[model samples]
Target chain A: MPDTLFKPRMNADIKRRSYYSKFIFNSHFLIFLTIAGGVFLYSLLGLLQTLESSIWLDMIAALLMSMLLLPGYRSLLKPADGIFLLPYETRMDAYFKDAGRYSLMLGISKVITGAVVALLILTVGHDTFVISLFLLLSLLHYIANFHINKRAINTQISRIGMTPVLFIVNILSLMLVLQHPAWLVLSLILLFAMGKYVKRREHRYLDWNAYIEHEEVQLNRYYRNVSMFTNVSHLEKQFKRRKYLDPLLWKPKGASFNKEKMYEFLFYRTFARDHDLPMIILRLIILFGIIMVWMGNIYLSVVIGLFGIYVIVLQMSQIYSAQAYLLWPKVWPVDRTFIQRSYVTYSHKSVFVISLIFGIIFAAIHPALFYIAVVFPVWGYLTNRIFSRTVYKKEQELSD
Target chain B: MVLQIEHLTGGYSKTPVIHDVSLNINKGEIVGLIGLNGAGKSTTIKHILGLLRPHSGEIRVDGITIGENAEDYRRHLAYIPETPVLYEELTLKEHIQMTAMAYGIGEETALERAGDLLKIFRLDTKINMFPTHFSKGMKQKVMLVCAFLARPDLYIIDEPFLGLDPLGIDSLIDLMVEERNGGRSILMSTHILATAEKYCDRFAIIDNGKMVAEGSLDALRDEFNMHGASLDEVYLKITGGGIDNA
Candidate 1:
């Protein structure tokens, strides 16, 4: 709570960042950034010369500003703070204030880049006053969006949903402001609505666990993004926090939150977070959907749907396989059969969702055969049941 | 008796690492399973936990053999390994919740007990944080919190103090004592002989894949003929030499 508490922590964090920054901002990254930035700037300037004032430019400006304006809140809070800082939690607001300042300072380059892009493109249509007003509205939206996001960390609210809605609101507001200065009132109202929606809950105290988990997720994201540019040691846990899909995850209540259903709990998380499974499954659906749409032949669509269901069902087995061998299942007092049952439960809903997507894709390709789209889910359920049986057999053999 | 092992001999492979190792822990007792490296302490613990099939003997918890009723056998026992083994995906709170679920404890009751244990170990607030990123000591504390939260009859702890700080060690000792007072049992395998001598009610010494001597401190001293000797001294004398003890 003391002003001094965060200073040393910030310095240490800076040092740690500097350590990884060298790896991230290596010669290769600089080269990539320069060439990519140069090409993008050149193309934009060239477009500006030929382009006229139009709504398309306004749309682009709105979209770009909205996309980049959500500079994520970073508190730099560690897991230990949940314990070590509890006595001082009431007074830790000063520390978080420091963290907010640092985060904004850290995000200045991103905000500026967004502004520059907006300014560069807005020059296509608008005069100085409107452009200035648009920028001012965007900056206000950015600040509001950032604070709301920070507040969401301490509540049970869905942060994932807030982000996309923020994106849409930013785009809507920026476009309205650009349309006419009088519309800025609507933009301001939209921003206030978002703020009210986000901060609806009252957090009596800091949710240290939430804050720390959020921090770790952010840190992992930084490392994960940087790892694409260069190898980083901190990216070992490939858990992509798919917070959006979490609503579908089993929210066990008092009665259902027992040993009989622990695996069901784990199965949902493993499918969503661990191993690139969800993304991979989503990609498979999209890829097969594309193929089905491309080859509009009804027969080909059915074939793609069958194979897609088969592949996705097979993919669902991986989470079960990974969990079966973990130490806790063996140690936990529950029967191993419960794990297989949980797998079936997980495969049931997840495969159905994937199959439904494929079905829609099929329906898009063949409108008259909508009834046949039902076969995809049936086929998916059958394959999953069979695959789950195979897993049980394999697990039985291993145990035997 | 909470855990009854009769001449249990087992290892990962067909060849036994612990041979004819017999140990019994009574209700309300804290028994230390003392041994050197490669001295079959973990093998014995594993056999008791039903993780390894004994080549020669059998183990029972709460008068139930694993084959008779595996879940019931496991339900009565909790094992904390030398190195903390945790789920990479589950958060600390989930681990405790999973423990409660596995033990058939009511969700609210398990959480209430876990809250008390977590507070004792200074981990109540970090419950939602993942253990994967925790330091070794913090992870060990999580293991302790989960194990104690279960309130099982017999706790099998292998090198329980390996990664624990002094405060953590003290908290664990206090919890063990409290659990014992509540008529539960603990089978702890620790290298910290001094602490074990001071706290553990009984001592079981294993050397060369066999339990050589086991009893109370004075009882073990009588068997080893080392009157007034410290536990380290008695342990060395039983295991035969510092070379193998190290």
Candidate 2:
């Protein structure tokens, strides 16, 4: 090879930004936000913004904030996360030195931030034991986090399933600190020792392939959920990149009558049998609950109900957004009727029916306002009529 | 007739990817489609599958036009996409059963065929497992199994061999031969000239949305005046030499 043409491989540092970005958008962030936001909003509103309501909420806020600070605090796992720099296995010790400094700083930052927040809340009670215990528990949380994170980064085990285990341990420790004051320092030391042991054991023997594979799997699942916001293909591409997406779902088992039937089958299989429906259901419930909570007056309830209707309609529209024929129909064994009929039957009619079902359910929940139910059929008709005449027509016209 | 395309001219939009393309595969024939990355192989397959409508052409399955009876037209052909498009929600077995139901294949037969396919693909252990857990090769195998389970008259497969292990490739070749011998026709597009040369009875080389040269390997070799050359040599000579006008 010519000396001038020789190019060194790209360093892993450059790839770390994109990798961490995937974690930020993963469902874990969403779950964390739901928990943190719910508590914050409830405390602010329900307690009339009282500064000294409950210690547990403050503890939760600390935990949630610690999670948010993870990107910055990831340096604490230098021993485990540094394995990426091991290709030059000779310089592994040098990489570990830098990584350890990074991890300790990050680990300390998380511990301090959490301890301060908990201490602020604990100050209202003016109990030294409460403040000391909260600090100890906060330290234990960082230690526990460092341990699991190293295990996950090293072993490539999914961190999502491990979260519940971590959460249980965390909650148990928090309870012990809050309700039992004597064992706080001892427990904190024990947790730190445990985390150190895990890091040492992980460093002793590591399987890089298993770790890389697990990381991609975790990243794909995270990215897949996030990609829904902007694009489905992005998520699809992520799975493709990770070699994670499976083809077993849409495999041909037998004959489809024609392209139309094939499309209809896809539409049904995509929506009715797919997870998007349950997701749709969940969003509806959440929105309904929010509306119910804020429905202080009748007028507000109706306004929320109308907004709910729009949300349902919007959600139903998303059901058909994943059209495979848009990309993969070149070798399909059917006709133009399949495309045309699929739009009319699959996208147009199906969404209309789903909106109606949801609309009626929303109406039944508030029967005192029976007049809202009138929008059920009107919205259904109007949506379909508008979609068929404009969108569906545009689709067909473009098809030609 | 197993599959037929006449004067097909269509693409994503008005810009036709396949122009006036015509081809046919009768019962028991394996017709290979050869092309470069952007050679419109997939577009032509899309037209045949009814994913796209020709600006001016007709595609028929079993002598019946697709538009005249949409259901019947799709019933006759099974398609395996280059990259299998599968639902993330459904389990592997559920995918098989649902497809069987759509095609109106009896449940018992679908299950038996599915089981056999799973065994052949070494996926018998993962029947209940979701595609989420499957490897790329495993997912591709799942797609193949699903297509094979259809047992349609025409099998339209695109880039069938990519991502397969040697065992998988061998099994696929055996399956293709078995399917063809059993009176089924196959329309497959591939860049693996060696594999196509070995298996395909006839072939059509398409370039930039136009049919460049099409015939048996011997005929293609003779046309290029490279009698003893392999399919790769013939292909390179024909493509590198440029398309001679019909």
Candidate 3:
């Protein structure tokens, strides 16, 4: 067999490409990026002007050391991979070795970037010896950390025990390099020896489950970050039932139930139980609320409030499409039109509630913007109507 | 006929897995679809459930083709997939209620049937628990309950015995028989030859995307010249004989 392990990675890359093509080229993304870039430049210039060289060096060292804690391999091992790929374990050694090299290259770039940032802040005459020594120590720390992590995968050493020890050692090695460069070579030799010892002592059995779990965590983290920008097709969402939010989904006892009513209830419960939709709405509201209060520009705040509502509405609309992947919905006896109507109705209610809160917060911050309380609901209703119509039209095309 | 599949040929993609296969189940009849793994059992089931469009054939439920009236056709059939597919967030009771709502089952009827099925499967006590933490067998039981609760005119069940406990299996057979006696039809696919032989009114044996033989046990015995042979023997002889002949 040809190395089939790359198939999953290839599929993921295809999904990622489609996702970016749909969202990254949009005007909303461009606007968001422009605002973010402006904020980042403002912060960077201020930090360079105010922070001292010593503090910058300390921060860089801490950051570079922390980066070493990340895993040094991307096995891309999914759950099914255990059964499918475990049979070819002996042949997979080369694949894993390549993954380790790739991870090390990524780590090197992160360390170099941090070091360059520190150099820019320390613009005055800097010690060449110290800089070179820091780079060498950082490289050694990365290699040693990678070996330790690989060993921990199949070894008696608990990750809880090994992680702290490795972190302290990495930090101490860097500190020694800065203060006393002569002792740096000795520390590197000792770290390399320890890494070799760990490798030699570790059990040979492959823990495919742990590897798959680790890879999934890494992949999920990447997908979750990308999901903030656009919908990710393969991201498995986490679900949580917030009991305190139950009252929000409650219906009166002995209430009459119909197809539409049941659909409405189901949609409500799905939204409340899902970890992403509700959290995304709350995050946008809080972020906009803080920016509005901090900037205290009534016009700008109102504009942002409107834009925030738009973004939330767009994201919330994803719930309607989400159920399409499920079987029960497609197999349900109810007409597709009724299902669409229920989705539109429930989404409108959710958006209205969210926009009302945004309006209340904006009014509280700037009493002059009290008109937002009225304007927000009207705008939300109109947007919901327009978005729902577009969504339904697209769905109609797909079904046809 | 409650269910009719005419010259159905389809798969995941353009290339067909099950080719030109035809089968039917009449009212109050139970038909067993028996085949080995990757022998197009699931592909056939998928065609019947309207999950996959037939490459070049038609499937009908209650005399209405899936393409002619998708919603109405779906309403007439209840499907139990080989692997249990349940929403992780929904409790056991919620699953049954959702199925009831989807099928438009009356509240009183739903309540009565759900109560009885839950008790029969010994899942009554766990009605409030989410299936997220359910064992494999428990999850299968939940799927069984969902399908049973639908009470549709036709039940398309695929490999219903896997991951089910012995008692759960017995309860399922009993419920399926009860449904059949009540004038509902069932088309079940399984690798469990003995169980299928015991419960099925007739058997349709498929191989390499083709139906090799389909009839009552006596008819199959007569055709294969395996007089008095068990269903298992007949299956092995047919498939093994095909390989040898090929």
Candidate 4:
């Protein structure tokens, strides 16, 4: 029965991805991806042309490839399975074997991608034989490493402690293999020893609770990544108490704190304490700023500024979508229209702030075109005005 | 009447879970919406709260229908659900503040009332903590604190005694009586008849998504021809009689 469950679960996961992929790869995101990828490739090729053959290239390739090792273990196991499947633990070997095969396929795809990315720089000094040997060894190590990760979850081993140890070993193994094909034997031996360590520490039964929590974390990480491109209705929002920012957060005074402005207050708090929204905005500004400065093109900066506002405004819409669907809002004494109006008020201000960051970056890039800064905030306000209505339309449809 | 539900027939979908469920609560009354599991207790309450639209009839609070003026209608009532639903990002204190803001209460007055309720529920020290991470009972107390802070004309509480400890239930019953004495009304739904019988001024018993009986304990006993029967016995008799009749 457990083995029969795995196929449907994997198919459902794939179907969910396919559903979200439509919105994630929509025209806006595709355009952004094209320009961003083009710029990154251009810069990388330019930098590579300036470099000569050296250990730094080998170290860089090794580091990047090592980072991709230890691919995540996704069992697709839910929290309730711990209770429901506990009595059937003795018959779970086939179920787990299927899960191992699924996870290995996922890890191998990443290993192939890493090898392709590393090959760009690895070709400088190393011949084809040396590179092939190192890549082959890395793939083998990853297969071994994934089993260690899976077994560690079943044992009393601390996962956090095991990660860095494996990471360093991965880096060392690759570097050694790059130096000589003979070192592949040493890498295999090390991998064997680690497997023995986990086998020795294995629990009598599976740790259902730990694996379930691990799966949830991986699921949330996937949602968080997808949320950057489009709203994820199923995302489990994580909040942080940034107490130091409370002084900066506006306090509603006198008349402004009434029923009409209640949602406005919540909207602001939602944006501020969200574990990702604030940081995502900051990271985008810095990243786009670096690219604009490096390219030093006036037209591109304009395009970048406007597009940054558009992306951040799209992100801000998630905050409204999050709040509107909550139970309290449906039951609150405030009028239903207050939320849309409050969202408009909150989002316009938020977008303006984000636009200001873009504008400032643009101004610093092109000091001669300081007046162009005005267009960014104005464009941000207009984008929010038009975009938030579509969100309200969607929310209204859901509620109706 | 503080609340009047007349011939309400509604459900989550086209099919109605509740059938012509008529009920009423006058000022200063504590009415127990008594029912078994899946007996439309929650559906009736949802209709009263305007969460689910009635398929046929109307629900009124303070003589105002939700369609006529939703803000005015909702302003008169506050709801505490069976399971505590909290803003994951907001602190306990902020929850009360949100209720006050939504109800248009002054900040100082809201906090003043919240302080008394918090002390009664023994949640004053945890006011700064996020109620989302609270234990089940404590989270229920946070719901209570938020609802009571609004001081609305009607309080719609669903299974108020489910998650509470004995002391917490005592505090809740005391608060309900206090609110009743102050001329406010409460409509609480629960299957725990023993707890309901102690404090409720009246009872509305629903069985199989229908209002099987409604009245005072004496009126119920007289109607059912069970003299001096306990509420649990009377409820079982009413609901069980339906099973036999079918």
Highest TM-score among the candidates is held by which one?
A: 4
Q: For every candidate, how close is chain A to the native chain A in TM-score?
A: 0.60, 0.58, 0.73, 0.92
Give the per-residue lDDT of model 3 (tens digit) for A99-167. 666556645765666666555543432477776767767766777788678767766667678777777
Candidate 1 local distance difference test against the native: 0.82
Q: Per-prediction TM-score, please?
A: 0.64, 0.58, 0.80, 0.95
Every model: iRMSD: 1.6, 6.6, 1.9, 0.9
Q: Give per-residue lDDT, candidate 3, residue B14.
A: 83
Error of 4 at A288 (Å): 2.8
Preferred candidate (DockQ higher): 2 or 4: 4
For model 4, what is the alpha-carbon lDDT of residue B103? Answer: 91
Model 3 chain B scores worst on lDDT over the 10 consecutive residues at: B237-246
Residue A259 lDDT, candidate 3, scale 0-100: 62
**On residues B110-213, what C-alpha lDDT tens digit does candidate 2 reach at each position?**
88999988888899888776675688888899899989998889998999998899999999999999999999999999988899999999998887787878
True contacts kept of 2: 0.22
**lDDT by residue for model 2 over A73-133, one digit each (tens)?**
1222223443544554454444444544445563465456555555555565447866665
Q: Which ten residues in a row are the worst by lDDT in model 4 chain B?
A: B237-246
- Predicted candidate 3: what Cα RMSD to the true structure? 4.9
Q: Candidate 3 — which residues are off by over 4 angstroms? A: A1-22, A43-73, A77-97, A104-206, A241-247, A251-256, A275-277, A299-311, A373-400, B7-20, B55-57, B222-226, B236-246
Off by over 4 Å in 4: A107-110, B241-246
Worst 10 residues of 1 chain A by lDDT: A224-233
Clashing pairs in 3: none
Better of 1 and 2 by lDDT: 1
